[model samples]
Target: MVRVHPAPLQARLPAFSTRLLLRGVFVLELATASWGGPPVQVPIGPSAP
Candidate 1:
């Protein structure tokens, strides 16, 4: 049997911050693409495989 332990809120904060950072970067890219001509190809996440 395998047991899984939930992470504490403090431990998850960094991930949340990283997500926010990614979102910000995506938005900036979107804005830049809008200003430019062609569409930008943004990956889903850091590791998209």
Candidate 2:
């Protein structure tokens, strides 16, 4: 059995938009964190897996 909570129609769009914005922010922060350390040097060779 599946049950769903009923939400007011007006709240749906705002909630979706807020979730999208938050996901974007999270991705940006993750990318910046990756860049915070010294860059890695990759030896020239066959493409790395």
Candidate 3:
């Protein structure tokens, strides 16, 4: 029989990084919205597969 194991911190590192990246984007968007600047173009890095 196969047993399932919970993921460890090392395996979750990517998820943590992704969350941080999203948070950064959110903050940037909020800042731009508040500033009311002329349509600033934010370059998002390549997405993960």
Candidate 4:
């Protein structure tokens, strides 16, 4: 039998995917707020008027 080792990047994939998902949600929320769907106060980014 042969043994195999996981690459460094494979170990970090889960966390990277989670972060990507969260960022996608944030972008969607920002787009909706800009479209006047609802008031989502994003105090850290550019204000869309």
Candidate 5:
């Protein structure tokens, strides 16, 4: 015999946050470019495979 489970119908928050973060980084880059300073590096997470 075999059983199957259904996935939960949850909000895709991780995907949403990823997109939001990327947009934020782009905006930050634009702001920093106008400042004429060295680029700041933010360590958000470890590198993935």
Candidate 6:
């Protein structure tokens, strides 16, 4: 047996936002290193098993 599903737009939006946020963070880091700004760290999580 198996199941099929389709992710809704609302669900997809968070994923899209997360990806964009990561890109933005990278740019922020570069700017901080070259231009100077407060550092920010978004921790991911603990080690996996």
| lDDT (Cα, tens digit) per residue for candidate 4, span 1-49 | 9766677779889899999999999999888878868665667657554
Q: Which of candidates 3 and 4 reaches a greater TM-score?
A: 4
Off by over 4 Å in 5: 1-11, 37-49
lDDT of 1 by residue, 1-49 (tens): 9866566877999999999999999999888877785865656887666
Worst 10 residues of 3 by lDDT: 40-49
lDDT of candidate 3 over 1-49, digit per residue (tens): 9976657866899999999999999999888886876765655677433
Number of backbone collisions per candidate, in order?
0, 0, 0, 0, 0, 0
- Tens digits of per-residue lDDT, candidate 6, 1-49, equal 7764556877899999999999999998888876676554545567433
User: In model 3, which runs have C-alpha deviations exceeding 4 angstroms?
Assistant: 1-7, 37-49
Using TM-score as the measure, the top candidate is 4
User: Could you tell me the C-alpha RMSD of candidate 2 in Å?
Assistant: 7.1
lDDT (0 to 1) per candidate: 0.83, 0.78, 0.81, 0.83, 0.72, 0.78
Scored by Cα lDDT, where does model 5 land?
Answer: 0.72
Tell me the spans in candidate 4 whose CA falls farther than 4 Å from its real position: 1-4, 39-49
Poorly placed runs, candidate 2 (over 4 Å): 1-9, 37-49
Give every collision pair in model 6: none
Between candidates 1 and 6, the one scoring higher on TM-score is 1
Per-residue lDDT for 1-49 in model 5, tens only?
7754443323566677889999999999889886766665655667532
TM-score of each: 0.54, 0.52, 0.53, 0.55, 0.49, 0.52
lDDT of 4 at 23: 100
